[model samples]
Target: MPSDIHHPAAAFNRTSFEACVVPYLDAAYNLARWLARDDTDAQDVVQESMLRAFRYFHSFHGDDARVWLLAIVRNTFYSLRSKAAADAKHETFDDEAHTLIDEAPSPEARALISVDIQALQAALENLPHPLREVIVLRELEECSYKEIANITGQKIGTVMSRLARARERLKAELSSSSTEARRHDVR
Candidate 1:
């Protein structure tokens, strides 16, 4: 049999897809991780999302690949979440007893950042999903309101409102945590 030769158009499409999608993998993973709240699940979501993105890449004509890819990532996460929810009904898992162990930080790293980082992370994680997503997209991902609206399929007004609410809640949580820490210090 003769060696199979690549079609020029197929080669171009593959190159274009890689160029557009590869650079934004980190951003996609970050968004998925924040939404899923688990590293393994986030990785799974990203992998599935990449497949979806590739399958539908021909339809993508937008200028911002990051926003487009993030939209796919967010949708993939929700789809997985829905399936997990359905599965959860038939299972009996005690989340409180299921703990995840994080890698230990160096002593100096812990001393410099651990307390504050942990508090902030906890606060972010405690926010409602809508609020947490807006925070991650706007602040951490540095996405503009228009970008967020496109990714979330929300109106611009809704995106702005959610972001404002998320910021206020974060401020309140951080302030309360700081006060509690100060009290412990005084004690």
Candidate 2:
């Protein structure tokens, strides 16, 4: 019986790719979804990023695959947006990202939350992509200023400024929506 041993270099290449890059797929997809704002577009971005990542994987220097793949995701989104002549300054969210908060929580967070708070989540989801991404990464992902800057390819000051503006806009939107509901109730 002859046992066939694959070449050492190809085996090593396969091992490294599976270990370093394959595990980051979910994280890549999530970040891409946020950036692209559409599930279909997100998938496309992920595929493109994966191909690019694999092509350049040999140059990777660190173990933080999340950040590396996320950079690819960000780059892919910008490439498509620019090619389509999208407004560089404007941020848009696709409908798939829309969702109301879990109103009837199975946990204790809801103990302190009222209908207004639930409405606030829905309002925040309606915010523009740039604003929403900052909120999601900062608040939900609990990323630091430096990490946010790296992921979005912005200066640290820009990340702080954008977060402040996004929070202000979200507050106003939630307040107005809640106020309109109250007005309707009174009517």
Give the TM-score of each candidate: 0.82, 0.70
Worst 10 residues of 1 by lDDT: 89-98
Question: Which stretches of candidate 1 lie above 4 Å from their native place?
Answer: 1-5, 86-112, 184-187
Rate residue 90 of model 2 by lDDT. Answer: 32
lDDT of 2 by residue, 1-187 (tens): 5423387865776688779888978877877776665677879889999988877877888657676777777888778777875454334554335444466774444433445654665666577777777777787666788888888888989889889988999888888877776664521
lDDT of 2: 0.73
Over 1-187, each residue of candidate 1 has an lDDT whose tens digit, in order, gives: 5423397876777789999998999999999888888777889999999989987888999589999999999999888888785645221222333333345966554443555666678778888889889889999899999999999999999999998999899899998888876655521
The best candidate by TM-score is 1
List pairs with backbone clashes in candidate 1.
Answer: none
- How high is the lDDT of residue 166 in model 1? 90
- Which candidate number would show the highest lDDT if scored against the true structure? 1
**TM-score of candidate 2 on Cα atoms, chains taken together:** 0.70
